[model samples]
Target: MLKFNHLFNTLVLLFPIFTYASFNVGFKQINLDKVGSRPLNIAVWYPAKNSGETIAISDNTVFYGSRVIPNGKPLLSNNKYPLIVFSHGYGGSWRNLSWLAYELTGQGYIVVAPNHPGTTILNRDIKQSVQLWQRPRDLSRTIDAISIDEDLASYIDMNKISAIGYSLGGWTVIALAGGRFNTALFKQDCMTHSNLKACELVSDLGLDNPELNNSMKDPRIKAFITLDSGLARGFTPQSLKNMDIPSLVIGAGIDVGDMAVELESGYLQQFLTKSLSTYIVIPDAMHFSFMQVCKVGAVDLLNKESEGEGIICQDGGTRERTEIHRELSYLITGFLSKIFLNTAD
Candidate 1:
């Protein structure tokens, strides 16, 4: 019996162990030709079964990439995961928020992000970028495309959809949540505060078009979160007061140029009276803190490419960017759990 027991123990030790709570991330890219005037390139991240080769996503010399299983099969289960649509900041691409996407997927949520035409780093079309209204439309169309995607739709819970954005992307999600834009108000403010960062892009944003005042809200998005949104001053107080969805507005405490918290995130928090709004300020974080982690010597490399691009790696306080991301992840996950799971911590 002792020999039999020893053999059994050896067998058990040789067998691979698996944790039920842990999940591998899956990634894929697809293009939708009908999304707008240009084809929209989208990146999707989701909980995947441990069955494929792990690879680095969006890896570059300057930024560290997240590991994911390319085209890995979705976890085998009847459960449909919550969907989170991410909108990247101006001049950013779908990979900009990939860190957060991987985190959310690990927590059992599916994330989709689109590289906005003209505005994304991959494709910068001055004419297409100037059409500000098209930004929100890009997200709305992305949601539509995902909803009909046979492979992804089966794993997504459409009813539990949420939107998250950073910088100008934040403004895009806000518009998705029913906030109306007041072009005249924005232009007048720009005239007064000419030094404001958003004002510098007045011509590019096409603020003169009265049609921009029309509502671009998409009812499919149940909730939203914004990080240091730009062009927020253009949203009318009445429109913000009328939005009834739940929202979380996070601002970086460090002021960088005209993109101050007061003019953007603070403005949103102040006027979102009717929504179940929660506001937070990360004291150690800067606007670029929301982006992916930078590689060693990345600052110098970026500076070499462009005169002031190195600021992307700079932060406000002594804490490292990864630390800031951990705090943000905690706050964001906690808030989302309350809304999606209806549980309090």
Candidate 2:
């Protein structure tokens, strides 16, 4: 029994516990009306002081992830923190990336994530999907709202803003970072690589309208981080070459095997000739693994609820979800700090 106890103690020592300051989370729901009557629903998360309550979250009755209760006041910290605008994947809700939001806020960042109205699961308008140009507009609008809003402006450092996106959101950030969309190129690639699932989806959505194009780049965004970017083939080499911002591309290793990583995230890193680009591949991650950690029995429920989309319920083999979040938080926070906060090793 003593020998067993010794072994347990040694293991515990090897896996040292990591902890952070218990800062209360302050949350607010803002309506960005600058973009006309159809105000964008912006979910803001920031550091606060006080207790919070647990609340339920959902995506148009499809999948239900974990609930979060933010505890704190509306007051901003004395220090001016960098702002991170997060764009969610297609048919994904703002709450989908709440886990990452929570982590960033806890580490001294004001994180604002908005749900792209028509593209979110709550709406899912195919016409909205086709007009992919609107995606980046949604993000710019969110940034504008935060800037003018008296409450949000005080907490954020306007000059040190960065953007992070996943899946379709990844494409949005790339566009915001100066990568222009090319529908003709996308079509040609699809014709050549018809077997790619992303191509098949694009063909179904028919996002080939040239009239919807616009200048999506925002000068305020100094850095961009993308994860498992989708439909990246739409950006031509010339458009990407124009990008001068520091960008990071993270992809799921499993996505490479699935044939989804090559066209978007992979393509961006390979073709961005002028930008400072860094790429990292999480060896065992899948496209959906970047979302919130699944709730109890979420896999079974998702399989029973939706077809083909149940892959969202799965994660990399033998890897705990919390561990993935921890690693991501560490890398992301470190990267942002180095560039925006001017904190160097």
Candidate 3:
């Protein structure tokens, strides 16, 4: 529902009142290099022994002051905690999901989020967006890097790696978990539903790449969680049926107006026969509501200066973003905990 501001490279740095949460957030960054692959900027968040200092975290478009213990001692869980990787949507930075990372780490999970080379906020090429297979490969490489990185490997239980993706990221995790995409499926939908936003995007961008059918399945990822999953038209019943891991699909109610609910989450819930998938449609939520909550006054400022770029800042009709985030974090933690720790509420 919102367009990314390409002209402005940055926004005014601001600090809003940050409430102290139940767990202290810690931060770390590392460079990931794979043979024949571009180096990636990876960010990590884990539970820390102390409440850290407030520092500016930039996402190209804006700077957020967050309280984080930089390089602080990670709170030991005795047993290796499960690893959760986060993937952001097209034209988004890894920090877009920082709220979720903080929540996950608080719940005793080590979180890794990497900025995908071409599709991130730093580079906004439509061609890179269509190269859908690369997204999952980016995640696989993160997994590879984590396995060998001495600092990360010791604290993470790589055996229980899971992923949480939003928008195109959802497609990435599905592909990583064995779902295949048939470009023809989307093409057919384009012919019948040309007025839909996704169909219009496919037509405008000419995204008929042959690599859409390739599978980027990574056996290490045991489960996936998706939100307002974009480009799911590429999936057919057979392709979705190939998935064997558990999945949680969260859809925005506002997307039902655009058919994304039906094409993506609903379809997966109805037809992904080989796995148990849980689907939840948040009533009145918008497509961008899945992203992190904006700081106080941030939405109004973006609207006044960025011309409705604040659309991403808005949430479901009058719903407090704080409440939404709290509910979602609880749901994600519970779902992942049940899977990885065998804990049930």
Candidate 4:
């Protein structure tokens, strides 16, 4: 009998220790030599009881003493823990939002965060990256290799899995949840819709892109969720025909960039076969609010490409925003619990 406190108390716990089990746990890289050109990087945060686990916590402490803070790990995989892959926004890497990774780990789930090829600041030239629409392909491939051959199988419960992506990662998750993305599907309209005409029509959106083959048909992923990842490219009614899994689509009140559209979530609802898919829009928050990269004082989340891009001044009014994130996490954890625990009631 799970009481209401088990759910509501998540937001208010005085001596809350998010422990080291959810701390910085990094896995080895995957080589895609046979399937692709170069090997890819995937940042992992495994779930474990935050109490006492003799595991290595990453301390790549580089950025502004931020990474210096140590040990508050993911929840325990005492039995078989479910896997949840997290996708980052455009131009960001796995190290950027370790906070989200750690928090999710505390909630009794294994989290996988992968750094998309060209989008990372490590190689700023987005044009050359194979991981654009290939992000989902990358996810599907990595997932296959991990489940089939990697040591990850010992730790991960591949049968019970979901995905949560932010911004560009949101779009990637959308594609993975069964939205179709084809490049030729929009090649004619893309030429006019995009301003960088001669600059090579690069779509952060993944619809109709040739990169999306049967890669999204991964059987292990049971559920899907996306945050601030409304489809940027176009999608047809038939494009989303394969979306049958339970889903959650989360968006922020304010659009930090021209990244997410207002009605895409609603659009997806129309196409989904399952009635369980839910949509949530957190009020008074921005896109970067979901990511650990942006902060109130020292850090700013507004992208230069955005009209909504501006410094979110924090003069002690950020508590509301924090509350919102905590609320969102609670909702996500609950939704995931329903799926992994098989508690439809």
Candidate 5:
């Protein structure tokens, strides 16, 4: 616990919020059935009149893997924060994404995130695996939970809320922003693969279940961001072409020989209806840009397998990846400040 305290103090000094109070709620029990309706043991990091309580900050693999940064942790909290909801990739924990969460919170946004059931730390548990299919519904529900639940209703300004997600979390944000997140599309993408990794990593997600996809209805979210979130299950110009809301898409391009991804952010900038949409491509990034240290450290974990397939991944350093994360933070904060904070929609 002292470790977290030291980590927290180091972070507090670096990110003194000049805007709003920052409070963090961590490692709370999550109700898989709840989304917008629940207070997800989240950390609200803004400029607050330091409450008398000294809660412990956790040490996860996020900041250079069990290697704490000096007087740092990007996921640290700040002051006078705006509200932001951060969704993590599949098969991770709330702590796994703490780096991004703390970063946003410290920068003055109330960041809320939930452990998508089957996609959590206990991922191998078969019964929990079912939660993967419940993602969109879960994202929507989490929004509802905070919006309607009396506990956090007074704290969050719904109009100021924005969402940042990566990978599957990327897909989930799209659905919340009114894009089609379907299972059939996932299946279609998986047809050529004949392996378990294909099923577990790509297809089995409930993102495709129509009953779930068609049921999502959220208006509180002001903007959407997808990192490495590929094509939506149902992407038609009609559906997203004229989405006037500010949309940012970040993706990657891979070199078949180098195992390096040419990072790119691809939103149809020309589609006037999707007027505010912007895209960027990160050079040499892989599919795991937006994850905790485990994924980043183990990046070679998959790359090792790539060698057998005649592919050699040029493992860029953590410094490079950290730079990418910084870029992400800057982009998101800037976008939200412009659209949700500085300018009125």
Candidate 6:
């Protein structure tokens, strides 16, 4: 018994207990009529002063929701927190990145994610989804609304703002960073790569319109990160070369169907000549791995609802989705700390 206790004590000493800061998540809807866009449903996560009733966010039969305090009082602090605006993949809602938002808030940062109308799961409008330009505008407008928000504005440091996106959202942040889209180039590529999922939707996506070429850059975002972005071929090399900001480009090493890292994420990093960008490929991850974690019987239920929908829960290698998320958290938090907190390992 004495020896066993000594061994247990040694093990405990080796792996010290870690504590996380308390945080709360709040939801709001902001109108974008002035910008000629639809209203946005947003989720804001930040440090909290007191714990409230803990509830599961985005809980459903398929995906497991994140547990967080809702509508709790904000933490009182003199120091301003860095702001991170997150954009989800096509057809995803703010709930898609709820886990990451919670992680960031616990680390003393403010995180906000907006459900882009038409493209979000809650509201899918074919007309709005085709207007890809409006996607980036959604994020820009989100920042505008938050900057003046009574509850959160005072706690955020405007100058320390950053953007993080997944899938199509990745393309959105790149556009915000001054990457211009070339509709003609995209159409030409689609014609040859019709097998690609993005190309398969070219007809419906309307890539030939000249309006897509317009710059949608938002200067407020100082740093950005992309996770397995799509439509990267639409951005011209010259435009990517002109993106002068700190960027972290992450890609899923495993290709699931039409999305390929070399053609999308790698392509972005290859042409980003002017930005101080870091590139990383998560070997065991797939395109859908970046989404919310799935429940035990999620795959069966998803496929039962719609054939092939179960792929959303699939990953490349043997590692579980939770394990992938841990690596992602480490990489992302380390990058943010290096840029904002000046505490890079």
TM-scores for candidates 1 onward, in order: 0.91, 0.85, 0.85, 0.71, 0.67, 0.89
Question: What is the C-alpha lDDT profile of model 4 across 116-148, one tens digit per residue?
Answer: 777776855544454465777767766766676
| Cα TM-score of candidate 4 | 0.71
198-315: candidate 6 lDDT, tens digit per residue: 7766655566668789999999888999988998888999888877888988899889979988888878877886338877777779999998899999999989999999999999
List ranges where model 5 is wrong by over 4 Å.
1-46, 51-58, 61-81, 124-133, 148-152, 182-203, 206-208, 212-215, 230-237, 253-274, 293-319
Each candidate's number of clashing pairs is 0, 3, 0, 22, 54, 0
On lDDT, the stronger of 3 and 6 is: 6
Model 5, 1-345: lDDT tens digits are: 011133433443354233333333322223534354322343333323333343434453323432122222223332223567767766656565566766665545656677666666555454444444356556666666666644445556666767777766776776677664456644764464323132444434543445644635367677888776643433433556645567777664433332122211233233315347756555545565565444344434555555442121232334555665675666555556657545452
List the candidates ranked by lDDT, beginning with the highest.
1, 6, 2, 3, 4, 5
Model 6 quality (TM-score):
0.89
**Candidate 6 overall lDDT versus native:** 0.80
TM-score leader: 1
User: How accurate locally is residue 118 in candidate 4, as Cα lDDT from 0 to 100?
Assistant: 74
Residue-level error in angstroms, candidate 2, position 166: 0.7
**90-203: candidate 2 lDDT, tens digit per residue:** 788788788888778777788888888667878777756666777888889899988877766876788888999988899888888778877788889888877766686763
Question: Which candidate would rank higher by lDDT, 2 or 5?
Answer: 2
Per-residue accuracy of model 1 over 1-345 as CA lDDT, tens digit each: 011134433443343321124578999887999554678888999889898689998789999998999998988655678899999988899888899999888888889999988888867788888888998999998999999887788888888888999998999999998999998999888887777788888777676778789999999888999988988888999999999889988898898777888767888888886349877777768899999999999999999999999999999999999998876776676667668765221
Predicted structure 5: lDDT:
0.51
Candidate 6, number of clashes? 0
Candidate 1 lDDT (Cα, 0 to 1): 0.84
Local accuracy of candidate 3 as per-residue lDDT tens digits, 244-301: 7788888887753565576666767767753477677777678877676677777777
lDDT score, residue 9, model 2? 30
Model 3 misplaced stretches (Cα beyond 4 Å): 1-23, 34-37, 51-65, 203-206, 256-259, 343-345
Candidate number that wins on lDDT, 1 or 4: 1
